[model samples]
Target: MTGHRARRLTAALFATSGYLATIPTANWLTTRYPAAPVAPGVLAPAGVYVVGLTLVMRDVSRELAGRTPVAVAMAGGVALSYWTANETVATASAAAYVLSESLDFAAYEWLRNHGFTIALAISNAVGLIADSILFLSLAFGSLHYLPGQVIGKAWMTGAAVVLLLLRRRAHHSGQLRAPGFSGATPKAVGRPMRRDGGGHDGFGDRAGTPTHPQQNETASEAMP
Candidate 1:
């Protein structure tokens, strides 16, 4: 597929996955895993969920489709989550995503020059903090799960960093596209071609060089 098309498909896929993660899926290993508390009553392992992928990928989506797609994804995710997860959870999740994703997008724009992983890492960190606070406070009425939430989301962000790293690898490997979905192969951004052949640019050597009448006229009067 073309570069942009690949990037779009990737963004859509990741966005959907992040949204779908909202609905708690049954883990065959452990059913309805309650807060097992990772630390000494600090937080429960069950509370540590991998739902933050939405925020992470949302940042990636921003780079691909800019702010519009990211906002739309957040809205679409919330709408879908409403039917899948409980209304309370969905509301809280949607609000958290909207606030956090928007923040992430803005931050990324300024910090992205450092690198993809670095940019997403920083943005995702902010997003996770916001999402954790908002969701826990609004949905559960308790920050008891905040620590666990952060931990859970950290894993998701790490995975996103890996993806960014991969994309950078592809970019360095000569893929001129920004790794999204699109129509045709994208042309690489490159430097302009130079007319190195014998031509009097009117700045330097004129011997054995052909010069245009307009250029020669301009140069002769300017120099003489």
Candidate 2:
């Protein structure tokens, strides 16, 4: 493979690996530590912080690896959770992971055309809320941890979004090359491409410059 393509593949694999690892890591954390208090009277899983990072990584995995592979990774995560966590935590995690991820996937896909940052923020918000409610209810048989869960996940999501926005801004400002869903490094935003597919060379062709004969042909006439 070309060096660029190989690099892209490597990045995708790394993102997928991170996504797969987060679930089991969170499960193990819950198994190892006592519940942490998030509010005066509320207690959330000690793994809440790691699970928050998992949501952000999930979206990144989808961007890099595409949908089907991410689905398989989700299954792998569920299996790992079952092995690493208590039966109740595993069951609750599985249910919440499947349902909340589905909601996140759907919302992200629908809003993706709007903008990456906007879609990510909204989808993560939806997923976080659904995950907190379902997992807390199923695992503890109550919503006592809901507030803590939401607050923790929101902090992670907001921080992740901010970092990504800064990265994109750097790319747009010609300070970096951003990897995006297109599998190509993005060109600096607002810079036009030439007809020959190179960076813009000049403001415009000389006023009387001869144009390619093909350029003068109408679109319908040029078709084979």
Candidate 3:
């Protein structure tokens, strides 16, 4: 019933829905152009996954006060899988996804803990490049039917831009603020509060003022 609890629930629901949507969206896109060139058709699913992952991870990063590098890596992996239609390519894509995403997660965590924003930015950029290379090499390295490598590279670049921009908007909007810890709360300092129980303030506090001690205590205990 509380504002914070509602925000958390909403965030959780959004994440779950977005994750579930990935499968169907990818499948639909892949099937739409079953006979077309893989590169072009693949872009559909890849674009969707990129947009969804960016929005989801933006909120996650804001809530956690850090970036979710695994999400970005997963975006690359998913794009690769959808692009590659072969069984062997699929397997390789899975492995690449797992490994790259794991590494990205670790790298992001390290950078965050060390207060290295620049390092985090650089690492994320490099990771994106590495993921794209590994994915393309595994999925389409042998294929000559697809257009020049530049096409795929361009797709990757575009996806990265979309993700970064989404992240920036989410951060600026304070959509990533954890439940119960918003501008309306006494503990919140810089962020502005929203009237409808969303935004930086989350839901309206029961008292219609800053959060009370009990609310703060509850929120603190829930921190991960």
Candidate 4:
């Protein structure tokens, strides 16, 4: 694989790991602090805003791993959360995550052709809404944490925007390839290279008369 492709695969796996990790992390945080301060005036379970983190992570995974790992991550996150979290919380988490991630993937695909930032921003927004509402409502059967949930997750999304800007800077600096969800890299156009003799341009043909054409003719003549 090329350097660019390798970078992407590593990034995708990293995001996937984060996605899976949020399951246990959120579980632990919620158990530790049923009401944590996401904002000065807003209190929510520490786990509430992680939905936002997952939203952005899903976009990165989609960009690199495409639909397959997204699906796998969702399923694996749910199954793993069951083992790592309270049964009730696990069910709520799984249900909300699957629903939100599905929408996130669809939104990403819809907006992808426009641009990476546009797609990621929109998808993260939508996913955060779905996950926050569904997870909170199902887990707690109340909207008391809605404000904190929104604010915390929004902060995370804002962070995603910054991360995206950095990614853009890296790409423009030739540290990475253009980010895309198209699942294909742009083919690089290259000048034909010369072999032992050198190139026809500056390196290949060093003689007054070109020898490649003559050699081909000579080989054909000798063969016949």
Instruction: Find the candidate with the highest lDDT and give its number.
Output: 2
Error of 1 at 204 (Å): 38
Question: In lDDT terms, how accurate is model 2?
Answer: 0.70
Question: What's the residue-level lDDT of 124 in candidate 1?
Answer: 77
Candidate 4 stretches greater than 4 Å from native: 175-224
Give Cα-based local distance difference scores for all models. 0.54, 0.70, 0.43, 0.66
Worst 10 residues of 4 by lDDT: 197-206
Model 1: how far residue 99 lies from native, Å? 2.0
- Local accuracy of candidate 4 as per-residue lDDT tens digits, 52-166: 6777777767666777887888787778777777777788888887787778778877876555677788887877766778878887889898888888888888887787777
Q: What shift in Å separates residue 122 of candidate 3 from its native position after superposition?
A: 4.5
For model 1, the local distance difference test gives 0.54
How many residue pairs clash in each candidate at the backbone level? 16, 0, 3, 4
- TM-scores of the candidates are 0.61, 0.75, 0.44, 0.73
| Model 1: how far residue 88 lies from native, Å | 1.7
Cα deviation of 208, candidate 2, in Å: 32
Prediction 2 TM-score vs. true = 0.75
Tens-digit lDDT string for candidate 1 (1-224): 97746755776666655544443431110124535554465663352445555565566555555567556666665676656556666677667766886777777767665445567788778777886788778777888777877777786668767775665455434422334312242222221111331111111111334544344334323321
Q: Which residue pairs come into collision in candidate 3?
A: 4-180, 197-202, 197-203
